[model samples]
Target: MIWHHLFQPFIEFGFMRRALVVCLALSVSTTALGVFLLLRRMSLMGDALSHAILPGVAVGYLLSGMSLLAMTLGGFIAGIAVALTAGLVSRRTPLREDASFAGFYLGSLALGVTLVSLRGSSVDLLHLLFGSILAVDNDAALFVCGVASLTLLSLALCYRGLVSEAFDSAFLEVNARRLPSLLHGLFLALLVLNLVASFQVLGTLMAVGVMMLPAVAARCWVRTLPGLLLLAALGGALSAWLGLSLSWSAGLPAGPAIVLTASLLFFISVLCGTRSRLADGLRAFFN
Candidate 1:
């Protein structure tokens, strides 16, 4: 009966099945990216880039009303533009990279909100900000899956370069020459793509939570990169399942529910994880 209660909603509803599939795909793909982001200390960059895509999404909505193709394209273009511009400003000017990114993203967020308020209804704006995973149709599912597939493939192809870049930028730059810059750009593109895909399911504001939280949680337990990636993916998938179940049983919104589940997992890991500082301190105190 417990199993029935957990499994029945997905079995009976097509949307639930689709959400599970999409969320699983997201978990596997985005969490892998998150691992690299965490190791590189660019965790907050994901949050900045998430907001940076807003103006583009708004522009897409203005042009085509809720057309997925238009919005996705717009968001991707905007994200890439902001990333590149931030990099350029940081490199050419005296401003720090993080500061450049923050300024650009904040401005982009304001522009996006203003644009959407001008032409779109409150409901439309809410949909863009909060997403409606339970209402996802076939086309959106396919798009999300396609992005996930590309993300995994790209990660595989760039694994060595990404690992090198994350751990030793100076070594990578000295030994590999242009490889460091190339890899940075490639990684940024992939990050943008993943964020765009996730916005369709988790909303732009909350998408990075799904990406970063699981990886942070996994770090508490795993020291090796491979182990971290594996555990983070598992964490994301588990969050998807538990979040969807809670949403169904309690009439909660799906997006926040899923992210909240990930947050819960993060806190639990911090408290009980063997490698966590809290656990280490407690052990030393007890002994």
Candidate 2:
């Protein structure tokens, strides 16, 4: 009976099924994006973008009664806006990209929270910040699937351009007729979409953590780009499954639990990975 009840939730409850499906879809997209973000040394920007979406989400909630669509659009817009602002600041000032991102995201986060407090109930604010998988519905599931499809397609179509720009913008600019700036914009858009879809499962704060930690962990073991992406997806999906199970069993928050699971996996990878820096240090010490 206990097993039946535990498993029955997935079968009988539509929301639970939707949540699982959406989480799986997002895991794949975010994992791929994470690989590129890590390579570009822009991992922290993922966290910043996630937080920057808060005001957009709040505004969406206020404008339309539909939480899912509103939040998705709002978050996407907010993420792009913050990224653009950070880029402008970095270009005009002497500040580094990371520093600019940090400043902008923190300010955006504070603004979002203040706006949410002014317009929404305490419970609504908590839900936006923490998230609840049990609240996922059919529309949210469809939205997640749509975003995932677009991200995958965009990446595949622009793979050559993206790789060129990422490796050497100057080289691409000199060699290719296409503008590197266009490719860069596309990458940023993909990042925003990835972040928006992930927000449902990881919330704003934890989404970046989930996206980056697994990729970082996977990099410890894999040298090739494809291998890294595959490992990161495996890590992300495993975390999602384990985190959902733990949340159900312990009556804890799912988003935080999922992020925690990813973090733990990262720690393990750091400790035991054959290619890890720590592994080399330990090997030298032992020898």
Candidate 3:
């Protein structure tokens, strides 16, 4: 019965298998990046970037008419632009990074929504807002895998700089000054790339939700950065499986199912985390 319920869907349907693959691929890069962003106190920054991509997606669709390549590229470029601009504004002016990101993304979101509404049908809008993971084809899979691999490798190479930037900018010294925004830009590029990749599989909202929930849950369990990354990845993988299984059996939408699964994991961690958060809170209250 268990095999019939779980294994049968995967074995019987190509789309089911592909959705699983997409989720697994997303876990690696998004979990790590999500942890990093949270460390930098830029968790909300991710939300801003996700919304900012809508304009680009709309423009791409308008120009190329539902071409994945065009929309992905357009979204990617827009994401990078928003990141860089936010970074620049934070550095050059009184506006804080989060505030700057907020300003930029809201504007972009408005523009994107307007543009998309001008041309596409409700079906197209639904696809853009929530993604159609079950419809992911071989080519989209390859693109996602490729982006995941690149994000992992690139972050690995720049690990030192990233760590320094996050925790000890004062210690960054010569090399950090030399590159200035190079490493930061690379990281933003990965963020954008992952957004684009996940945008295809889970849509903008669920993509960001999946990444953030696991990272936050993992944070509750572990204090160390590496531990957070590892646990988040595992949590993401499990959420994906649970989400896929629920979607297949219950007939829920794939994006919401996956995100809800992640949310469940997050809440569980908050209540029974390794850190004993709930227990500590109860004890404190009783005392």
Candidates in order have lDDT scores of: 0.93, 0.82, 0.88
Cα error, residue 257 of model 1, in Å, equals 0.4
Q: Order the candidates by lDDT, highest first — what do you get? A: 1, 3, 2
Using TM-score as the measure, what is the rank order of every candidate, best first? 1, 3, 2
Per-model TM against the reference: 0.96, 0.92, 0.95
Number of the top-ranking candidate, with TM-score as the measure? 1
Per-residue alpha-carbon lDDT of candidate 3 for residues 198-218, written as tens digits (9 for 90 to 100): 989888777898879999999
Instruction: In angstroms, give how far residue 81 of model 3 lies from its true place.
Output: 1.3
lDDT of 2 by residue, 83-151 (tens): 898999999999998999999889889988888887789887877787766687777778878888998
What digit string (tens of lDDT, one per residue) describes model 1 on residues 217-245?
99999889999999999999999999999
**Candidate 1 clashes between residue pairs 3 or more apart in a chain or in different chains:** none
Which should have the higher TM-score, number 2 or number 3? 3
Q: Which ranges in model 3 have alpha carbons more than 4 Å from their true place?
A: 283-287
User: Which residue pairs of candidate 3 clash?
Assistant: none
